[model samples]
Target: MPHMFTISPDFPPNSLAGWYIFNTWFQKNTGLNIHLNLYNSFEEQTIAIDNNKNDIVYVNPVDAVRLVRDKGFLPIARVKNRLDEVVIAVSEENPISMMCGLKPDLKLAMTANPDVNMISMMLLEAVDLNNSNVVKTTYDSYIIVVKNILKGEADAGLFLAKAYDDLSNVVKKQLKILLRSDVEELYHSLLIGPELADRQDEIQTLLVSMTDNPVGKGVLEALDFEGWLKIENEEMEFMIDLIDTLVPDTD
Candidate 1:
């Protein structure tokens, strides 16, 4: 039997293919029989972690914080292009120059994930938008959220700046960023569960040094990241505090 690692299904199909390629290379280099496990939702992924079914996992910032605080997961490395903040965008033709200019009947589109939803709520609060008047719609992906805005199904959308940058030029021209938040306190993280405690140092070394090889470089390119950076427990304290403040109670 091989060790199983879990990842969130938030990535697009093409991106998932790249991950499979990377996983194959990782197994070849590390001489470990590890399997890639993909879950369809955040809830399912977290449940696997809580049940001690996962060895290593890739997850968003909020889940990383939760797992660290509650499930004894250790943060190892993070994507080099980790997001600093999220953006609120409106269609260019909407005539809304500022977030506050948004009308009460605004149809807000956002991904259903906890981190994004929390940020979306914070952004709405910043503009003093009444919750009652805002029509919130949840989607599976940032691209869908942005598309809804372009198709006139949403008045505005919340997405990471990186996702917006990845949009097509024509799509980019049709949207205007109303505002961007200050540096986010959290980042997407690679985590090691208790099952991999003995192999922590070795795994961390391999991941951080992955880009030294051609196979690793190709994996990084496919994932749209420069490289991984090792993270310390102390470095994640701010993110933990921020998550605690934003969510209050995860249970």
Candidate 2:
């Protein structure tokens, strides 16, 4: 048996069933025994990658930029499945400008994913976090956050695109969208590791051709990915801009 490489999945332990299917698929396809270090939170996943507890990790674009710049890592490819979205919503009766008018006193809820940092930065840019009324509450899952807003526990909520689609009926009836993020054009969710930078060609080939193999095909489908593509340097440059434009001056 060769060295067993590890991947920190984007999804929690077996939460999507397909994640494990893809894990097995990639392991068999690459001839590298693969294992998953399950994570319940994005913070945990980011820390695991930062500490070298996982290899060839999957991360959202925000975290991806952080890993590459802060850790001198490289991305082999981005996930073909791009489900991340940022939603800014308010209750129907409340005017959209109410939060800004209130200044640091308005209540907001957001998904607890570290990648959500990008969304938060956008909102802060629109309104000063210090000058405006902004109180934040976090939930482990986006669905819970949606529920909180629906039940009047929260004044507004930010959620992923899939969650927004799932809650379409309720959103239309009771909530209003204040803002939506820009579409990710070259947004490959990113497959990366510091150690694999030199093997970019091989990794990209394996991922793109995996579909031709039965096991590889299964993993691709499980991950909700069509296939991986070679990332251009320009794509990475775009990510850099997104980060610079988004990251706060807390440094």
Candidate 3:
């Protein structure tokens, strides 16, 4: 019998497809059984982890910070979210000449849930939230924010790399990049949970040693994962400092 490891997957295409491919590869190469549990939202996944529901999970940067503090989970690898450009979008016609000059009256659309929008808020505070008059537009998902902007409900919107990629030709053409943050060297999608921590060496071996075999290579190709990197507590501490400066009261 093989030790079965469970992963909390977020959504379809990227989440399910990527997990299935990686799970197939991991089992064949390492002889450890792999399973994935799909969730409708990151909220569900985060709760599951807190309740000891799964062995591992794929978390976003914002959630990764929370896991580091609350769950004491170790990061084995980061899913490279290729699109690095964080866009400051305004109405296509607006003449916002500079990043600093963008008005305080700019109504911003952001997700109400912390799991999805906390990182963006952290990024904004790092830039200068005190000076800006940002009206928070709440929604269930980030896609709703894009629609609010197109309909003239918002003056500007914050979006990740993939949001721009998935935009329609018209919407793509309509939006202007008001500003983009400096490139982040590494944005981690950490693997969390107590089970993974106890079996750290085994987990690391399974991820890093994958490329040695044919089956393992297939999963790596699907996930676009180069390999695993052993992240230290000090690195996670840097994120702690950043979060502290942004949301001091609660991590």
Candidate 4:
């Protein structure tokens, strides 16, 4: 069977084509049978991981903990200059002028995406809001989260920064961005499972050098990445530890 490669569903939907192109590029270069398996939601992908051996996977910070610490996956590379940031927003007409002004019994829309949820909770700490104070409505995607907020179903919504930026101008104008997290160190990474340990050096080398060629550069552009950066072991551990500290045990 071909080695399966998949990306986190939290990635921009528009990048689907680029991933396909990347799969083709990877196969051509290494002469390996690399299949690009896709999942529409994070739950679907999680279920898949539990069911099968995914040789190469690209996932966000939260999922990385499971893949690395639990599943024997090694973090190889991450996209350069692409950090996972959260944007908390509300309907433009809402009277809540500041983050701290948001009070209890508020309706909050968000996805079950762990890192975003964790960061959102931490951000709300500025206002002394806890999960108990706000009633959170989980959505399948950021689009739905924004939709709920705009329709008054939610007082505010938490979104992945990239997802929020991808929204059309028409949609963005009706929503007010309350605040965005500036966590500059966290990002999604391309990881290789234990089964592919032999190819670690090869995969990492190709990824980091993609910027040298036009075809690879185009693929990077399609994914909205400037380039790839090698993730050192110590730095990777630091990122995981930081996440543990930022989010409490109760969260």
lDDT of all predictions? 0.79, 0.63, 0.60, 0.87
For all predicted structures, in order, the TM-scores are 0.88, 0.78, 0.74, 0.96
Candidate 3: residue 179 lDDT (0-100): 65
Error of 1 at 151 (Å): 2.8
- Candidate 3 per-residue C-alpha lDDT over 129-229 given as tens digits, one digit per residue, 9 for 90 to 100: 63245777765455677788878898777766454555667777877776665556436454646555766666676676667777667677776666555
- CA-only RMSD, every prediction: 2.5, 3.8, 4.0, 1.3
Please give, for residues 150-199, the per-residue lDDT of candidate 4 as tens digits.
88999999988988999889999999888998989788889988988888
- Candidate 4: list runs displaced more than 4 Å: none
Candidate 2 global CA lDDT score: 0.63
- Number of clashes in every candidate structure? 0, 9, 0, 0
Error of 4 at 243 (Å): 2.3
lDDT of 1 at 48: 82
Highest-scoring model, lDDT: 4
Residue pairs clashing in model 3 are none
- Which of the two, 1 or 3, has more TM-score? 1
Clashing pairs in 1: none
Against the true structure, candidate 4 reaches a TM-score of 0.96
Choose 2 or 4, whichever is better by lDDT.
4
lDDT of 2 by residue, 1-112 (tens): 2332334333433336776676676666566666765676666666677676665666666766776787766767766665466667777776664435434565777766
Model 4 alpha-carbon miss at residue 134, Å: 1.1
Tell me how far candidate 2 lies from the true structure as C-alpha RMSD in angstroms: 3.8
